[model samples]
Target: MEYIVEKIGMSRTITVPSQAVTLLRVLDAKVCEVNEGIAIVSYNSGKKMNKTIEGQQKKYSLSSEFNRFVTLEVANTEAGDLDLTPLADAEVLKTTFTTKGRGFAGVMKRWNFGGGPASHGHRMGRRTGSIGNAEWPGRVMKGKKMPGHYGNIKNSVKNEIVSFDAENNIIAVSGSVSGANGSLGRVKVAK
Candidate 1:
């Protein structure tokens, strides 16, 4: 099963040897539909819900409508046999989220390409040179690195859970996580 969480920023653990950790806030979720091996869950954000969502929530007998919805699938367990509360006991989790948008970037910043020398007469410094070859393969390679859009892409990272506050709906995980603060994240058991 997957749970919707919000990125709450990064912090350092207070252990003897401090380590970086990412804080995540578990949003309120309600099961909207239950099937054989799939369940539809709705997550509540700070924003107000629209009419369409409100109607769906009413149909499910939920008091409040949610801002986002996620479909969770279990291998062999039916919806009735699943328990969403197990997220608090997860040791290792895989988090999927979008990273911070970097707009248009150059090869140096995007791909860490070694640019040309900055000395005088080197007008092509910091530029991606030799994009093509001779007549044999005149066109550029398919996966050639070039300046273009970077970040804001969906990425998954496996993190070790440092701590969990079930009452407060907060989870602390070791290492960095994708996305900026307040960005949506999906957390699930690491395979």
Candidate 2:
């Protein structure tokens, strides 16, 4: 089963040699329609809404709080509240989230390039040093380790479930998860 969740940041368990865990809060969602294993689910997000969302609310007979809609693989057989039973029995989860964006980065920060010597006469301190061959392949090659955009890309990680608080809809999983705190992501039961 899949659920939309928000990253609650990372914390450590209260035991001997505490293990690091990433906490995720499952958002309250209602299944609107089901087709095979995928269903259109509605959940509350920000207050921003448009006519299209209003029409969806009318069609699904949902309240104004449930302004956002997404299609997900759910355990519900029919349209209703999202089932949380699957998560209780799940031993692992595959989390998919976007990494933090570090826009317009340099080669040193982006590709971990060792810059030129920090001497007084060196002009290639942080620049890409000699990116071409002498008349052999005069142009810079494609997929070179030069600087450009970095991060803000989709990343997936499989984590073992540490604990699940059903009443609060919070899940603690082993290790770290991508994205900043409070960022939204999807978690699918892997095991």
lDDT tens digits, residues 1-191, model 1? 67788999999988999999999987777656677857787777667888888777777666663665678753324322235467666799899999899999999999999999898888888898888989967898899999999998999999999988878888899999999899988888773
After TM-score superposition, the amount by which residue 189's alpha carbon in candidate 1 deviates from its true location, in angstroms, is 1.8
lDDT of 2 by residue, 88-185 (tens): 99999999999999999999999999999999898889988878878877888888898899999999999999999999999999999999998999
User: What would the TM-scores of all predictions be?
Assistant: 0.86, 0.97
Model 2 lDDT, residue 153, Cα:
98
For candidate 2, the TM-score is 0.97
**Cα-lDDT of candidate 1:** 0.81
Error of 1 at 163 (Å): 0.9
Span of 10 residues, lowest total lDDT, candidate 2: 130-139
The top-ranked prediction according to TM-score is 2
lDDT accuracy of residue 186 in candidate 1 = 88
